[model samples]
Target: MSVDSASGVTVPEPVPAGVVLRPPDSSVRRNQRLLARLGWLYSAPALLLVAAVTIFPIVFSVVMSLSHVTVSGSGFALGGFTGSNYSAMFGAQLWRYALEFTLAYTFGTVLVEIVLGTLVALVLERLTIARGWLMALLLIPWAMVTVISAELWDYIYNGVYGVGTSILHDLGMQQPNLLGTPTAAIISMAAADIWKTTPFVSIIVVSGLVMLPVELTEAARIDGANGWQIFWRVTLPQLRPTLALAVLFRILQAFGLFDLPYVLTGGGPGNKTESLALLGWQTMFSDLDFGPGAAVAVSTAALTLIGCLLFLKVFRSQVGKEEL
Candidate 1:
């Protein structure tokens, strides 16, 4: 202790155990800002690449959708801004039909795939033998390119010499023109999609299942919970987020349905199987209507974004309710 010169009062020296507060050095702040700038410098190349590939195309599509676009011998020429593209898209009957077909097809296929995939994952989770081999086999369809798979399905649905046709003929179904009719074409295309994509969902769910804590199920079993009870009370809730992730991925991919329908049915039998993506493709490439085609693409992207947002909101609310 010492007396202060100005106040003539005894003051205690600071204890070694007490924290001493001081203003941060300007050098420290300068160093932090320098580090942040370097970080951004390092990230700039990849960010520019993403902008070139993804953001530029999306912005260009939106611009084309909202403008008058013409294709010349040189390339696409953009005219003055106009709403005619969107107006034409909204006025078209094919647009309405394609929107409906895309939504319905996405809903049906995604729901079926999720259910079947979850079941497959559950079974695979319980397997004690050849699990790795079985998983590899299951992924074969998903690993195959969509165009190749679609071609394979096209052969299988061929009216004359298809294995499927032969089997059905043996069972007395006279004419199973799988891709010849509207309803059959839609169903056949959906079947092909589900066959190739279900394994993707199964892989995702299997990963989630592998990460799940075993203690919860074990404790539930000790509490006299049956398999079904344990699954319902313990597993399903935990798997909700995993299922939501699978659903989101499926929704995005399914809403943009093109390759399967294009390769298998060619959107034929009165354009009954034409999806939004296929419609956009036909409008852009076949008719060379870039503006309206861009509008269709933009509309489809907007719808997909809205659908995913709504699903996430509903899922969050459900999770909140379960927590409550």
Candidate 2:
């Protein structure tokens, strides 16, 4: 005999017709329902805090970018709404140069980091002795504070008392100021960043390597693959995602380079090493041009976001290829 549900039509029941057949009582079910709701209640505070800090600043920046906000005679004033701030950013050659410099800095540093970091991770993976201590040693530079490291490099690059200057004179050359030239200064800045962040990239890559399937590699070896061949066929494809993540992170971090260049070059040598972040800071604080500064910040942030998205897109395609 068939019985209808609560919204019921007529039913032929095994028990009495009016007797509803409710599902069996379960403490587990009731507990699960309570826990699901409790989970949301617990997470609400942290989620709200994150939204307040992140969303608010991004919204405020976009808004300020649209308006001509300036420090007025008595106080800050919004000089109505216009896109002149962003237009000025585009028209100025300074901003364009800074943008190009930032891109080059990001590419150079991240490329070096990826190559060196991967090599380091591979060496560590094959190490039979003192790997843990060696990993710790590698992490020391990464743990050092950015400003302190930059200052240390600046001292080394000093025109008078610098190790660099001493070496130059010992080689019978004139006194050298590493930061006094455009190319040398840019290279010096990239070197400092590579020293600081390569360990970070290696650590992430090493984690991915740890999860790599040993059996698959062994199988490839048994099939007559050499070290490079097995790596090319087995390990590299597996590492694609991890490498993509490493590149994305370094790109974002290096694109905002300010502290190192500020300490080392002060954006001088014709402002050849000036980054957009440095420019934004100068505009906002040094020149006190709020509108243009916000616009710079907004444009840079947008560009970084696009870069991240593109990396993810390419990584996703690589993943699909692996599946096939």
Relative to the true structure, candidate 1 reaches a TM of 0.90
- Identify the runs in model 2 with alpha carbons over 4 angstroms from their true place: 1-37
Candidate 2 whole-model C-alpha lDDT, 0 to 1: 0.89
Q: Candidate 2, residues 38-84: lDDT per residue as tens digits?
A: 99999999989998999898998888889978687797777678999
- C-alpha displacement of 7 in model 2, angstroms? 44
Q: Give the range where candidate 1 is weakest over 10 consecutive residues by summed lDDT.
A: 14-23
Model 1 scores a C-alpha lDDT of 0.94
After superposition of all CA atoms, the RMSD between model 1 and the true structure is 5.8
Instruction: State the C-alpha lDDT per candidate.
Output: 0.94, 0.89
- Residue 249, candidate 1: Cα error in Å is 0.4
Q: Which residue runs does candidate 1 get wrong by more than 4 Å?
A: 1-24
Error of 2 at 107 (Å): 0.9
Listing every candidate in turn, what is its Cα RMSD in Å to the true structure after a full C-alpha superposition?
Answer: 5.8, 7.0
What are the TM-scores, per candidate, against the unseen true structure? 0.90, 0.86
**Distance from true location, Cα of 239 in model 2, Å:** 1.0
